[model samples]
Target: MRRALGVVALGVLVTGCVGPRPAAPVATAIVAPPAWRTALGPGSPVRAEWWNAFGDPVLTRLVAEALANNPDLGIAAGRVDEARAAERLARAQLSPTVSVGVPTTDSRALNAFGTASTNLTATPSITASYDPDLFGRLRNASAAARAQLLASEGARDVVRLAIASSVASGYITLRALDARLAVARDTLAARGDALRIARRRAETGYTSNLELHQAEGEYRATEQLIPQAQLAITRQEDALSLLLGATPRAIGRGAALTALVLPPIPDGLPADLLRRRPDLFQAEQTLVAADRSLDSARAALLPNIALTGSAGVILTTALANPVGIFSLGGSVLSPLFDGGRLRANVDLTVARRDQAAFSYRRSALTAFREVDDSLAGVQRSGEQAVAIRGQRDAYAAALRNASNRYRAGYSSYLDQLDTQRGLLTAELALVQANADRLTSYVALYQAMGGGWTEADVAAVRR
Candidate 1:
């Protein structure tokens, strides 16, 4: 028996010298551009609280509220907590386990004398077991769990960035609707004055019924716009309320759409996106976890070594004094044959690791595209707003000339009506263009990662 045990121990020692396979190499296929296609030289660094750049206290407050109370964020936090617990469990595997137990028994039996007697036995023991990690399997598993924890944290930050962006964009739309409503009401009031003037001219016989009817029709056409604008405002308010995670209700007003500050474009190179975006960070961490998991699976093929020990005190009705007992043992469980189950596990981990690598590549490419798209939007929208503003000014001047010509009997009412229509259309277009410009900035900020960084995550972890 001793010779056989020595041979087994020798084989285990030899196997232990050959450790787990080295980690496989993973590579990302995507490449970032040298510079942004719409690069506007260096600008201000993106602030962590990017919404503050808009200089609207109400908008800032809304974003804060959404971050704190949003259900999606809460769910994300819960996932993070779960990951933390899993990490703890994995780490526990690296340490020895100790337990204590007490057991008591009573029995009645006939002895040699044929006498029935009751005897009670009580045994209390403390045991300890340890896995001497000769192959680093437990260490790799612990590392994998730690990587998963970081990935969960990154996912949480991604949700946080998304919620802030949504709140800002929703607020911008609400304010634009407010501006449209104001323009509609102002135009209706002006048309009402023109209708009164035409009535007086017709009664004095200075104008024909054709001119009087035309003015009244124009006034009514403008009147309908007020109701349309009000309806849109109500819908927009409700939408903003939802983003605030509150029941549909009236939203408070802040700076007018035109008065709101246009934040400076955030500046960063395309390659920086890898570290700036939380989604990208999450993807990278997921890959790391897969790599560690693969290592652990490979390590499973090696021999497992365990050491166990126990110490106990026994008390019995027949014993004169308490008895002490102790035991020590060691084991080696090497997978000599398992129908290739261990190798199959390694293959499965390899496949999953490759999948994670591809996922990371996809995420990096997507981040690059989003930044480029947002940059173009910010530039093109600003240019459109400029052109629309100039057009609005020209239409306003023409309306003044047309109104005077009709009142002085030099032109027909049709000429005044055409100019009025052009001016109103220009005003509405200008409002939309301005709103688009502001919202483009919001998209740019979001696409640029909303000032999220891997360093921030590390700081929180610490």
Candidate 2:
């Protein structure tokens, strides 16, 4: 009969220990992402690694190195590990906890007739305990943790985008500053030549001292601008080096800013952003996590059913008296009058879930706006650059004509100075416009989600 009871108990335990998996939840829709601008040229979807459009091998190598070697990326990887660990911990709760042991005991006893007796005994047995999870408590907790793991993965991807974009932006700015420095030095040289010509002409009584002094002053002013521009370039270079996780070195990537070609903006379907951008994906994961938490909180209100059994020998080994015993049992707990605490917890979780839903909506809208803004930036910047191109050509021709006339004694040195300055100014503006155009394309690429891949997502999940 005892053996039959044991078998029935084992069967009952096995049948009772099962968990339910819940379906994943999706959040409400926000504004759709803006379609990419393709008016610049006919194009397919642009590749997300848009920095490669710069077509510089050095820039590619530098970006790859920074992405690989960055310490902050390592920190993000650690967070992935932490989330995965939490997921494992949550899953572990679904399994029963089992333990086994044998115990021995001895005691001396005196009879009424002054006789003493003692015996030592050991009983080996197995014990187990489990929370059946019939109300989905454990399952909901595990689901919550799994959602957090995915959320952390998305967060890591976000961090990766941030690092890559920062490095690219810094490099682009550094190159722009380098171009500005070159223009400043060339302007200074032209002004110095003008000063020399004026001084020589004045020495021969061909020009006035006033003209000579004016030329010298213009030359000195241009020379001063050179150092200021060079200082800016140095600071930017140092900053970019730091972004690449390095001490400042002689980081001279001499690709002219004008040489960088802006790839045509892509025209992706607006609905595709639901899977493309990491921030949006992260927001979705956050909402899922909050939903799981609500389930967990609600489950807490239900009566908890637990089975705990132990079969370990308890030995009392006092010198005068020793004893040993074995026992097995279980406990069950139900929420009986918790002063509305369980309801309050459930309400709080629902509120937090609503908060996550709102956050997701905000992120989706922001992503759409970014795509729109970058699209406009690309088209408008290019148009503005086209207008400047004409101005630049006209200024170049005027500078040349003024130089020739000054040498031929037909135009004043001031005319030459002014025209040359005008030409340099136009050239600088054109370089800046070109850089801005490229940066706008980069922004669009990032808005479309860069660097994240299926493999990257898988790796983070692992």
Candidate 3:
């Protein structure tokens, strides 16, 4: 009857050891529009070399260089490695651990026959211990670690996309600044010619001293712009140099903004963004980790079954005898009470998992917003650039007509001054508009997660 009661108790304990497993977290489906409202180019598959869409070899080179050398990218890659190592460690926990120890002892003692004896004994033993994952604790912990590694990989790709876009955008800005500087220098030359013409007209009685003074003032004003434009060019160059991990210095020139070709706008489905955007993917991985953590926490509340065993040979010199020893045992530990700490851990993980779900939802919405914003920016900026180019051309013609009319005494010097200022303003605006359009394209590519791939991630790890 006592044996029967013990058997019943053991059966109850084993039943409790199974506990309850946490269910996987389910993600809510988010609906996206079938098509973008913005008038962007047709959507297409992502290219691995998205920067090459600009058709600027210089930009392509710069982006590649930044990917290979940017310090922020390196840091992200390091984090990926760290996460991978953590995953490996978690996996190792699922396997049993075996260790060998060799112990030697020298002693002076009396033997069984009452004779004094010096004896040396050496015993080498191998021991192994394994904790069975009775409630899937090891499995849950490993899954959580793997999700963390995936999140790290996604983070690294996020950094890669940012660095590539930034490098391309910086290069575009530098080139635009160079174009503006050229415009400033050219305007200064034109102003000098106008001043010379005014002086000649004044000497010949074709114009008054007031007009000559106005021309001189215009020339000095245009001259001041040259230094400012040069300063901007220097500043842009410095920014690009840092992206390349190089000393602050001049960068190689790329094709003019007008010479670069724009790729067709991709009209990718909104739902596709979940697959393309690294940040969203990272958030999802974080959610997975949270879910797994909750499972591991729940599993921790159950009893753990562990098996320990050892085997070795012992030699006694005094007795001239060799003896073998072996033992095997199993133990079960169930958490009876810990002042509610176990339940608190469960609550903590549940709260964390809920937070992760909210974070994942927020990230998805943010991704959608970014894609929409980039699409609008690209479309509107492209339209603005075209309109600004036409305006610049019209202003240039007006400047010429004003100069001609002044030469013929048909218009006042004030008219010529106003046209010259308008032409300068229009030219500068056109340059800026073009650069903005190009940068908008870069932004769109980045918002779409560029051309990052698992292969690229593997390369980064290496």
Candidate 4:
């Protein structure tokens, strides 16, 4: 029960617990503007487990392997655990503190009674203190700690997302090199056949020696591309191995470039987009921390109220006498002034909070831009792939016709070689198209805030 005495002997009575105020506008702005930037497909169901969409069991295994063993991710996870421990420590500050102590003393005393005596006393005491949370300092500190914890967990999820993306990008690059190499080898073989035919015709005076030499030149050039492609493939393999937290070693190749399954990207709702991103969430948490720290600093200006109490037992015994004792006390503190220190601290906290708020806003804008860029890239690449496919098919048919005409002695062999070169270029373009599509898939997933969820952040709180 509680009663308040007002001016002129007016009085009021109140009952029940007083609670926290309605949260501030800053707290409400944790996520502002429903659509961070136009959600991809409103109501589209994003797969909770995104990596599984690739459907390559080996890729899934490799991603899992890296997540478990990669040192970078391990370090990130450890930081999350550290933040959680700090949060618990901060929370403990909200409770009363009690300490137990014991002291003993002995003294030699001489009195006018004509006898000298030694007196010994043992004092065992327990002191308990509570700040009473009159100003909520401990509570504010705890809020900062909790906010820090969320940010740390967000960092961990960011690392996890990067690892998965690196693996996928490496896989795509390696396979694209593979396709290019194969095309180069096929071109070399065709050039070899043409060169031999040219040599025979030149020896019989049916084709000029200059034509034979040109065919030989083209064949060797195609041969040169093979080594270059192989070198690139090796370098890419080394990079992927490092991402997998391994030394340079042959990696298990999964699906072929053409067979790689692109995951379905769901454009979640605008509100969902605002909430799904880890960096955005992290920024918001940091802002909350700053806000609480500001409150803590502001509270410092108020008079500090402490309720301290000590209860103890004391014993003294002589040859014929004994004494038992007990005591209790409390304390209160008030700050007169501090040469503007309190105000300065409050100002500093406010500045930090402003910085945090600005960072959060910028992060949200960047996230929206990334999603837009990824979507545009996917749209253009898909259309370009369609157009390129038609071009490739037409060039292939032309090359076939030219080869048949030359073999029947109705057209020059050079015509067949030129058309084959065109066909080769077209085939490589298809490989490029496949790679572009796969990259788009990866980008889409990454833009969706590294697949972070509220539950993941909550887990780190443990």
Candidate 5:
């Protein structure tokens, strides 16, 4: 009865058995506009498989393969599973633990009357113990674990988006290399024909040796490009192989550079965009977990309460054959002095929570910046491609006119050479511009967080 009174007195001292409660974190208020500052084209919302915008079957297949086979994504998936297991462990703490045990022994002893006696004894017992969550410590820990699990899942989605975008960009570059290689070979063939004409003119005494030598130099210069381009193609194929987690092998071809088109995209509000990105979700979940951890740390300052009980039976070959025993008890442990460990823990949690909040805000700002930068890249690359195309056409016309004048002995060989070089340079630039435009589209899609979604993860889990 005195112990019971002590418990009541302590409860009264600790605010009626609940102790002090920590305040919940306030909601962060964010304002976003209706649309992005960058100019947007007319289109529908981006689909989960945004790579389909390219309309290339080969590209679509490559992206699918990368997503299925990439090791980084596999690692992220494993982290999700690990976090889920931790959550289960935290939740298990809320339940009581009960165990049963049985022990048996045979004993031979001499009694006080000088008679030897043998007896068999058995004792069976059941023990149970439970820690009540009077101060919400267990509940907060479980909540924090749940938040960590969600954060891991979001991190997996972030990896998925990166893999998809990388596959698309690599595929575009490989195709561009193929187009550029074709241009180089065609130029080499044209140079061969011009070299033969120059040799014929020199043999007939119509052109000097200097002109013939210049023609030979130009022909060899163009010839060297074919081997250089082939090397680039090999290296690009190797890079793409690594992305797909495959060995260095021949990469498949896709649509020609000229046949490709940039898919349209609609610029949604910043708030909606933020919701779509997995990285942002990850940051937010991390902050939630940090807040819960802070709550748990504060709860540690209160008292810990537990209840214990046990029941047993004893049996023996004697007059008082069987016996039963039962007992019950409770405990309360309050923190009086701990060298300031509890206060240090609380301070540490607060610091971590503040860091998470800052990280979340930074992620939001970076996401918006990525979207804007990609938008600008797409627009500028498209304009550059158009200008380069016009320049290539004019160079082609000039080459034709220069060749005609040279055949009629009206202009020098230098005119034809200059025009030919200009045309080749313009063509190569156009190919690069096309590649840049396609990759910019890829970046925009990734920034918009249109690749994978929660459904994809659920399917994988199932």
Candidate 6:
């Protein structure tokens, strides 16, 4: 026993000197910019339920339904559960395991005097074993699993934010299509009246057949727009239904395209994006998991210590009394030789950690670009909508003037047709511009993480 103890002490001392070295700390590749390229004015902080900021109850309700039923969210949740289980498994390795076992035997055997004898024997034992984690291997593994759990949770949030944004943007587009259809129908009605007036003038010799034909052709052109708009609306509704995780069907509307309130610009700094965006948070956590895993892999190069003990009683029918038995022992396994498997694992983990670092950098850069792009979209689209509205008003006035001049025979019917076409074009363009402006707000909200915070992930971990 003294020799065994001396050997163990010597081995431990020798292995400790050659244990795995700590890896160099990885630094983030990209730094956050001081400010956004497109400067935004002061605005409210992002809301947890950012979709509700649009002040449309229907849009809010749809987003709620989608969040509750989206299959992608279900998958993400399953991954979180899996990560939690993995964390538990890793943690279990740090603790001792106890088990009970029983063995029984019945047999007939010849005794020392050559007489045949029947006997039964039974041994029941309680055994325990543990890995002392002398090298911090199990702890690093548990930490890696914990980080992965947080990453999975962040991924779930990313899916949720995306779903909300998609629903809001789709709803806005549907309303825009509705507004365009309304415009087409209204223009078609006006064209019908003009065609009637032209027929009357042609029959009474007040206008020629050329004017009558032009009115009929313009009326047909406006009429075709109605069906085209209807087709587009149907497709948009179907697309929204898919987002809602329902069968293709009509979507409820609470506000017109022009009436839907524009959500406030979500306020966030570039640095804040690291914590505000779930994707970025997920990426960072993934990097953490990889780093911890690398630590575990490096620890694998060191010795593993295990302690085991068992206590039991053996009973035999031939014996006069039961025999007591007990054992306690420990082992140290140091990797003296392997075809480079342990070293290769360390290298593999290093590569994975580096990949995670670069991926996090890419996600951060993407988030910055998205925020700037959405800001530009919101500002530029708003400007375009304003200009288009002014143009629509001018076209409306010109159409009225053109119609009156044609009625008074001061201009040809073609002049009125030209003004009507311009007015219709401007009205359609205005609807699109409004939708673009609203959807840009949606994009900005999504880019700003839709009010997600690191605390949300912390709460889940707790």
Give each model a TM-score: 0.82, 0.81, 0.84, 0.81, 0.84, 0.85
lDDT (Cα, tens digit) per residue for candidate 4, span 1-462: 000101000242344964332221122212212221212233322235555677776666666666666789779879988999999999998888999988888988889997999878877888888877788887898999998988887767677777877887778888899999999998888889888888998999987898789889888888999999988887887787677666565666668887878665443323344355666777888999999988888887777777777777666665344344555555666677679888899999999999999998888777766666666677777888888889889988998898789768899867887887788888889889878877877776687664434444343334
Query: All predictions: root-mean-square deviation over Cα?
Result: 17.7, 17.4, 17.8, 17.1, 17.8, 17.5
- Residue-wise C-alpha lDDT for candidate 5, range 232-306, written one tens digit per residue: 877887776666666566677768877777786543323344456778878988999999999999999999999
Candidate 4 or 3, higher lDDT: 3
lDDT of each: 0.78, 0.72, 0.77, 0.73, 0.79, 0.79
Error of 1 at 179 (Å): 0.5
- Per-residue lDDT of model 3, residues 1-462, tens digit only: 111111111222334453332231221232111221111122332345777788877777677667666788778879989999999999999999999987989999787899987888888889999988989999999999999998888787777777878898888888888888899999999999999999998999876898899999999999998889877877787687677666565677769977878767633333443355777778889999999999999999999999999999887686667888888999999999899999999999999999999999888777666666766777888888888889889988988898898878898989989988988998999889888888887887787667434443343335
Give the TM-score comparing model 1 with the true structure, all chains together.
0.82
Residue-level lDDT for 284 in candidate 4: 81
For model 6, the stretches where C-alpha displacement exceeds 4 angstroms are 1-47, 111-115, 266-270, 452-462
Clashing pairs in 3: 41-265, 42-266, 42-267, 43-266, 43-267
Q: Higher TM-score: candidate 2 or 3?
A: 3
Candidate 6's TM-score: 0.85
> After best superposition, candidate 5 residue 340: deviation in angstroms?
2.4
Q: After superposition, how far is residue 275 of candidate 2 from its true place, in Å?
A: 2.4
Higher-ranked by TM-score: 2 or 6? 6
Runs of candidate 5 exceeding 4 Å displacement: 1-47, 104-108, 267-271, 319-321, 451-462
Error of 5 at 60 (Å): 1.1
What is the per-residue lDDT of model 2 for residues 59-83, given as tens digits with 9 covering 90 to 100? 6666666666677877888997999
RMSD of candidate 1 to the true fold?
17.7
Q: How well is each residue in 57-81 modelled by candidate 6, as lDDT tens digits?
A: 7777787777766778789889989
Instruction: Tell me the lDDT of model 2 at 277.
Output: 72
Across residues 1-462, which tens digit of lDDT does each residue of candidate 1 receive?
Answer: 111111111223334463442231121222212221211113312335778789987787777777766778879989989999999999999999999989999989998999999989999999999998888899999999999988998788788778888888888888888888888888888888888989999999998988889989989998898888877877776666666566555666678898899875423333443355677778988999999999999999999999999999999897889999999999999999999999999999999999999999888777766766666777888889899889989988988998899889899888888888888998999888888888888876776667433444344335
